[model samples]
Target chain A: MLKKVHCVRLDGDKAELEDEIAEEVPLVIFVNGKHFSTAMISPQMREEFVTGHLFTEGIIDGPVDIESLKVESNTAKVLTRHSTTFLESRKVILSGCGSTSSFLDKKKLPKICSNLMLDRTMVLNAMKAVLRSDNFKRSGGFHSCGLFNESGAIIVVDDIGRHNALDKVIGFGLIRNLDLKDTFIATTGRISSDVALKCARANIPVIASKGAVTTLAVEIAENSGLTTAGFVRGNKMNIYSGGRIN
Target chain B: MLKKVHCVRLDGDKAELEDEIAEEVPLVIFVNGKHFSTAMISPQMREEFVTGHLFTEGIIDGPVDIESLKVESNTAKVLTRHSTTFLESRKVILSGCGSTSSFLDKKKLPKICSNLMLDRTMVLNAMKAVLRSDNFKRSGGFHSCGLFNESGAIIVVDDIGRHNALDKVIGFGLIRNLDLKDTFIATTGRISSDVALKCARANIPVIASKGAVTTLAVEIAENSGLTTAGFVRGNKMNIYSGGRIN
Candidate 1:
């Protein structure tokens, strides 16, 4: 998902030509033959993307719920029992109830009931592991994610888009039937309410990031009973929500 | 769309609980009462977002095409003559052409024919102006944009989302009837293909950023005939595409 291109580089009054770049493609996803959404992403691990998107968006419970996922060029056709149901649900929710109502409802989402605990040192190491990935070091365009537990970051993935990286990690978990409730998610993407909602849906109790945590994400994390930390640089971090951190 | 939140700060091994955060919300757009897409955005510039989104997506030519924009709570109702046409076009394109062909078609977008030239010193100053904004200095969460020309940065806007920031700048231009072809866009967000496409649609020839540029963005800029540069920092930059820089 990359391409070599000649670029003019300027540094401290010096100029030189070089070749480096990662390709990005617009991937339009269709659910049950209906258009869902479009994302500019790297053309890889698309099935994981479809599965992760459906599961995290509350469209499906797990990867088993996806009947099929077919990629025709840049488009992904995802089939699931709830494919049409999810679309209808979005329409009903949007047309019937106001957008703010839905926002409030999600904000008041059920608390994630888990007893997961994370060590500061371990989480810092996990953040370091994500930062050490070739994708981050090379492209600087990709987002990275690592699923962590008491042991450490067990599964790691990267994608052109931040949300896609998290989705890939969740999809991996769903396929492995991992106990998500006890899992902690470490990522290199800004933590938004969308990310918080996804973690809530997956029953993830802790989320740590090497980036900033927006206000809504913090609120969602606090309300949903998830522990979230941001700015995981070197040995420092900020826990935005939940009080279970040690 | 901001809220106050209490947070726990950790430096190395020390921790302190405090308050510091900016809010985020989901803004759902409806055109002619039909549900469009939902965006996670800062709520300040809903109308600009609607107008810019329409203009940049090639849905409407400019702000003159929009008849009205109404915000009821968190939902934006945009009224445009091309609303139905745009929706229909998306459906037809997605269903009829599939995905890959459309992707290729966009990738081969014609070169921007504008002969606008930008000086390195002026652009570096523009980037500095964006970084000096209160939004960037205070929140550290908002993405910023500054519309520039021969003189310097003219209009600057900030939002939680990078796309929204660019939209605000474009909407500002549309309302004031600015000559967009001669404009240079300076931003503090990653220049993805979507962003490149927006500049192409606006007939803008120069896009400079203090962030990374994805391969797709470079390709789009190169194809769409726009001069694009990234990693504009302290007296340095890398021009990925186009040759309109002096």
Candidate 2:
């Protein structure tokens, strides 16, 4: 994306109307040359998006299943050849229901094993960091989510949507070859079932948000043994489940 | 909507988060009980939503086709069977693109009309008022869109997603039995083609936003003869097409 913006309609000093021409990048994900999805995203890291998308969608059980990957035009083309071992695992083809109602029947919730004791201060600070540095704050056109570890330090990535933000971070971790086990994710948006399911896909343990959590989201977190937190403002929050700082 | 929320994670002595739970309201459009699409909307304004929906979709060529109208909630239904004189028309089904893209193939631009003029003061002022009162401002939740008259004064509603807000206003207008012709819609969200299409469905002549407008949206607005505006702020905005200020 270009850093400079020009106004098309100027009523005063402010841009009442502006002409903004952006350079578009392509993210092509090819499942064995059979294209899966094409995403137009920031070109900072292409492989992260591809790996994150594949892993989140359960296309590959482990990173090794991905035979080859390519990133172009900010587009990440993930190439995985047909193999019985990969196919027999039964990946549920989910209609992308990012943070909304899903088209498919709800899958069995993810069961968590590693309960993460959240560092509340780290979360609060991370949230402030997110707000202060948000691209949306400048442009008012983007959404983001963040991931953390037990220490509550900000890790992972941010994107245009809460789902995309989380996906980018997961993808980043995959490209850099990071661990998925016992990770925590924090969002600047609501904790709906769609988000919860995304966390489950990553095998994340603790999920926190600067916004509200829905009833079904809480239920999913509980059933999955995932620690859910919402409204994590400075020095305060509501834990929707077994996630409590010990 | 409920006011005076108390959340443990809220800013100290500051505004709380705004949350509006969605409910299914039966919007029965009885074109001779032929059963138009079952619209899920707020129950408060059954009639207005129906009329606005029908008009925007270009279903009725002026409101006189209907012989009578009635609205109901759970058991409430709208008996809107049109007389045979107007029976020559069938409701146009405008469906959004499939879920994966969730974006319209916007390159297919609509025909542009050059006759629409809006009050600049009204457009900017309406945007200010709606943004000033957003749930995002108070509870830091929800997105908002406002419908404006050719005069530019905001008439109906605002919401969480760009789509939901427009729907609420449509639902509100439909229930109140308002005139939707020669209207403009303003939003704080990105103006995608789907967003443009939604406004087009209502036959809204102009669509404005404080955020970005996609390429497809520009095409749709041009072809549909809808004026498109973007990057609306204090005193300035970008007029994409079909929008002229007198």
Q: What is the TM-score of chain B alone in each candidate?
A: 0.88, 0.63
Q: After superposition, how far is residue B99 of candidate 2 from its true place, in Å?
A: 21
Cα deviation of A237 in candidate 1 (Å)? 1.2
Stretches off by above 4 angstroms in model 1 are: A12-14, A81-83, A86-102, A106-110, B1-3, B12-15, B86-102, B106-111
Give per-candidate clash totals: 5, 35
Cα error, residue A88 of model 1, in Å, equals 8.7
Give the per-residue lDDT digits (tens) of candidate 2, residues A136-177: 465444555665665555464544456557777877666656
Q: Candidate 1 — which pairs collide?
A: A2-A23, B111-B224, B111-B225, B112-B224, B112-B225
How much lDDT does each candidate structure score?
A: 0.77, 0.56
Instruction: Kindly list the per-residue Cα lDDT of model 1 for residues B132-218, writing each as its tens digit.
Output: 988676656678898988888778887778888898888888888988888889999889877888888778889899977888788
Q: Per-residue CA lDDT of candidate 2, range B188-217, in tens?
A: 777755567667665577777887665545
Docking quality class, candidate 2: incorrect
Which candidate number would show the highest TM-score if scored against the true structure? 1
i-RMS for every candidate (Å) is 3.4, 10.4
DockQ versus reference, model 2:
0.16
